[model samples]
Target: MPFLTDPVLTAGAFAAVPQPEIPTGDGLLLRPWQASDAPAVYAAFQDPLMHRWQLRAADSAHEVRGWIEEWRGEWATARSVQWAVVDAGEGALLGRVALHHIDLVDGVGEIGYWTVPAARGEGVAARGTSALARWALDEAGFGRLELTHALGNGASCRVAAKCGFALEGTKRSAVLYTDGRQDVHLHARVRGD
Candidate 1:
């Protein structure tokens, strides 16, 4: 069976090239996750806010290494990708940004991000997200990117807005957290926007 429209991006669009490191103008860099980052990632997950929003906490650096391995493997499949947001000067881990749930045929992918406790309030999330969204939508040829966060997360709401992901709508009880189900705000940015 044929479809009415062609895939917005080809299957190997992302896998064809090595994942590139993106520099956020604000002195932050989004780079591929490395095994050496496990300690920082593990420590970041220990923050209460990070633990709460992420819905899981890393028990050990070993576990984080597994995650890094999995994130690296996803690049080969080209279905999902994650980047470690780091300081450009010292390369300290600041946060993470990712394009997940990618659908090449539709040219859409969802964005997810979080900042280390120390990096919060410094605009790391927004800067990193913006850089990745630009790479995904402009350089990588994705037509649209979506960002959804649980309602009442003002920080995340602000990050979404700062990155130009317009609020599309809310999905009631759309996400399950450690506490309970919560409403989710859906934001999006299209290629032209």
Candidate 2:
């Protein structure tokens, strides 16, 4: 794919793609994070499921506030794009989906995302991820995209599969999780050859 940055291809009026609000099948909407989201994020972490799947340790509201700020910084600098998820009907904060590690030169990037326990299995991750992947390839002009997860995370594997990522095998000692150096499954989706 030729490397060209078209302002119109982006979702909104920004030099780069303006983060758009994406709605999951189950009525979860993903938009940009705001300072007010800190409270919900802090609360979500208290769920053991969120802690286990999302690799989260204990965090305070202050830290979550700063975390939301950092994600916005990426858009400010044209570095990465993120989407903050909310329950569509209730409008309650849920989780986040992001396409970070962007390399415009090589037309490549990586995807990372996580949702609170209450938000999982509603097809939120798959829909959010597929939307981001299609946008990354068609709008962001990336040639290849990658996603990674620890060996035991079945849910993540399912999400990746739903988004058309091909499993590329395990990387031994690839990631050092809380359990020490752990192997990880690598998945990739490449644009038309």
Candidate 3:
């Protein structure tokens, strides 16, 4: 059961330490999602745009709490991690940033984020995503990270560019949306870039 190469990251790389809070330098901080934040999470999902891009909608504070629990569990498994992007002073939830589809053996993960209706156009997504990317590629030892979004999602494209994730290519009919299948833009960033 041995491979020719060693894992790029140790299995317990993330689990070995407490999840650190990341500051975006834009009055926002990315912190662990809390059960008490369920109400805010639920409110954000009520936005039509937010619900459209997300894989699932939080119908109630209870569902959001469940999601927070699941997200916390992933940290232990080293499979994925999610953070609540909040106002640094007020601690109000403004958005979310996450690294999913993680592969410790390859040192890669996918980044995803969404901003609340009130936070849109405020650079919340860009700032939060940039902070997470730095942590993932520089601090966390990930060799590569990817950000993908539906072709029509121009805002997301801008966020990727702002965060230094170069557009790799377009994935034809890559994902299904509420509207139907759509082409997706694939962007990526690697260590030292």
lDDT per residue as tens, model 2, 53-98: 5666656999888888888777755457788878789888767788
Q: After superposition, how far is residue 62 of candidate 2 from its true place, in Å?
A: 1.4
Q: List the residue pairs that clash in candidate 2.
A: none
- Tell how far residue 161 is off in model 1, in angstroms: 0.8
Q: What range of 10 consecutive residues in model 3 has the weakest lDDT sum?
A: 50-59
Off by over 4 Å in 1: none
Over 158-186, each residue of candidate 1 has an lDDT whose tens digit, in order, gives 99999999999999998889999999999
Give candidates' CA RMSD values in order: 0.9, 4.2, 1.1
Report the lDDT tens digits of candidate 3 across residue range 92-190.
889999999999999999999999899899999999999999999888899999999998899999999999999999999988888899999999999
Error of 3 at 101 (Å): 0.2
* Location of the lowest summed lDDT over 10 successive residues in candidate 1: 48-57
Model 3, residue 157: distance off in Å is 0.4
Clashes of each: 0, 0, 0
Ten contiguous residues with the weakest lDDT in model 2: 6-15
- lDDT of every predicted structure (CA atoms): 0.92, 0.77, 0.92
